[model samples]
Target: MIIVTGATGALNGFTVEHLLQRIAPSDIGVSVRNPDRAQHLADQGVRVRQGSYDDPDALRHSFADAEQVLLVSSSDVTADVITQHRTAIDAAVEAGAQRILYTSALGTSFNSPYPPLAIHAATEQHLAESGVSWTALRNGFYGDLGDLLGPWQATGTIAKPADGPFSWIDRRDAGEAAAAILTNASSLDGPVNLTLPSPVTLTDFATHAAELSGHPVERIAVEDEEWIAGEVANGVPEAAARFTLTMFQATRSGHFAHPDPTLSRLLGRPPRTISDQLREQMVRTE
Candidate 1:
């Protein structure tokens, strides 16, 4: 049996849906913290088990009789992130999983200023020592430029720190690529960077938004502190604003500029672009 963690959330939920289309539901299992949220999956004949990174025994039982396991990184952003991953890794080993797949972030490193990337880096290191064959899907940055460009909606001006291009892959593409990897578990091993083949800068995003909005939108470079203050003034929590600032700082340092084609190779098509993602979001909101 193949087990998937976090099957209730967006990324892993899409992964599970794609897996269901390609494989038999009886051959699949889901380990979720809240079974109520995933009753629909169980109703479809999948083995839904209650599991959590915080509870080791529950996690072990969740992976029982599994040959492969997909460990979606915890959505929690606190310092407990590393510990949570470690707990899951240990449980997977105890459950005798032959192969493990992890959802990791691109640009993750031990020294990364971004908390999530650093946590992913540490998790990758722990997985390396697990002795069970494993793969880390280093997914690209997600989120529309519209999120960062919210201020631009009213002012028609996009302002942010000068930064390099980011290979921003959509969450849907990332999920599909993950399902493909998990299905062909033995075909590849080690860390694979799942990113778009091209990177786009903030200026490119502004141009696309202008076309969609039918208005002129100008890009303006501002000091990082000023940008953070503006975001806070616009109702973003102060801590969240600071975290976004770190992402931009990392981007300006070329952390997210790399474009890898592994995701395209796996999906057999080019991944979605920033413009396409933004357009889809606009339609959804409308």
Candidate 2:
């Protein structure tokens, strides 16, 4: 049996839905923090079990009878993130899961300034020492480039501090590729970066947006402090604004710049691009 954790979340939920198309429902189980919110999955014939990274016993129970398990990294941004991931990995090992899959990030490093990178790095180390065969999907940054580029629907100006290239990707495509990996989990090993084949900078994206909208969208680069002040003036929370500002610094240092074809090879097609996503957004909001 194959078990998927965080199955109710947007990314993993889509992964489970796609997995259903490739595998039998009875062969799949969903381990979520709250089973009450997962009745819909159960109604679809998925075995729903309650589990949380905070509770190792629950994880053991949730992973019962599973040959392979997918460990979706925790969303917690605090120091507890690594501890939580370690707990889950230990539980998966204790539960006799022969193989494990993880949803890691593209620029994951032990020395990255991004807090999440540390969490991923630590989890990978623990997974390696656990003696369980594992695969890490180094997925790209999944954000609305249109929003970052211009908040384009409302503002025709792309405003931010100078940034570097990002191979922006669609989450749905990531989910589909992840399902494919799970289907053949045994053949793959170590880290596989699931990113676009092309990387685009914010300036290039703004140019494309202007051409698509037939409007003159301007790309404005401001000082980091000024950008934070502007975001705060627009009613963004101080902590959120600061965190977002640091992301640009990370970007400028070439964190999210690499592009890989692993995702396309898994899906048997090209992953959706920022332009494709923006065009769909425009059509939907029109």
Candidate 3:
């Protein structure tokens, strides 16, 4: 059986559908934090296992008789995710699962300064030490950028704590890559740097959205200290948020950057452009 965690999320949801397209429904297992909310997937013929990442024993029980386990990483910063992910890894090992597929961010290395990247890097190391055959899908910035930016940008302005170029890929496309790896049982033995072929700044995206939506855009220069202070004032709790914007500033300083067509190559298509993703946002929000 093929097992997938975080089954209700966009990445996991899309992966589940893609897996069905590539294999029989009976071959799929989906792990949800709550089984009650999994009716849609259960109706689609996925065997839904009720378990959260915190319950490693239950996670192991779920992994029982599973051949491949797709462990989707959590985006939480409480270090709770660290505990959860380690538990799942240990459970998979105990269950003797043949292989593991991990979802991680792009460009993670041993020396990453970004807190999220650092945690994922440590998780990658932990997985590597477990001795199971594994595939690490190092994904890029997701196309959800516009959702994060649009409301603020559309209010007579566009702004980011960011000041440099960034490449982004659609979440669905990344999901397609993950599904491809599992169904074909292909080992992309990676740190696969998944991303769009081109990078652009939030400033550039604002300018383009201005042209498309006819809303003139403006950049509000909040210094790293000021911006972070504002976020704290505005109730940004995770230390990751401050660290995230710092990475953006680092982008201006020429760190935390890569522009590879590895993801496009995997899917035999080009990654979504900023404009393409913006249009998608327009459709989604409307």
Error of 2 at 219 (Å): 1.5
Candidate 3 structure lDDT = 0.77
How would you encode candidate 3's per-residue C-alpha lDDT over 1-286 as one tens digit per residue? 8999888888988899889898988899987888887789889888988766788878887777789999999855565777778888889889889888899887676565455677788889888888988878888777456434746445756545756666667888888888888877457774777777877777767777777677787756567777677667877865745766756765675444678777888788886677887876767777
lDDT sort, best first: 1, 2, 3
What residue pairs are clashing in model 2?
none
Q: Tens digit of lDDT per residue, candidate 1, span 1-286?
A: 8899999998999999999988999999999999999999999999999999999999999999998999999887654988999999999999999988899988888777676888888899999999999899899887555676665767898788767777788888988988898788355788899887977788998898899889998989889888778878989898998887888788877888888879999999998877788788668767
**How accurate locally, in lDDT, is each candidate?**
0.87, 0.85, 0.77
Each candidate's clash count: 0, 0, 0
Q: Model 2, range 231-281, lDDT digits (tens) per residue?
A: 889999888888887677778889988888898998899888777887887
> Where is model 2 more than 4 Å wrong at Cα?
144-147
Stretches > 4 Å off in candidate 1: none
Lowest-scoring 10 consecutive residues by lDDT in candidate 1?
Answer: 143-152
Q: Residue 157 error for model 1, in Å?
A: 2.5
Which residue pairs does candidate 3 place in steric collision? none
Candidate 3 wrongly placed segments (more than 4 Å): 146-153, 232-241, 253-255
CA lDDT for candidate 2: 0.85
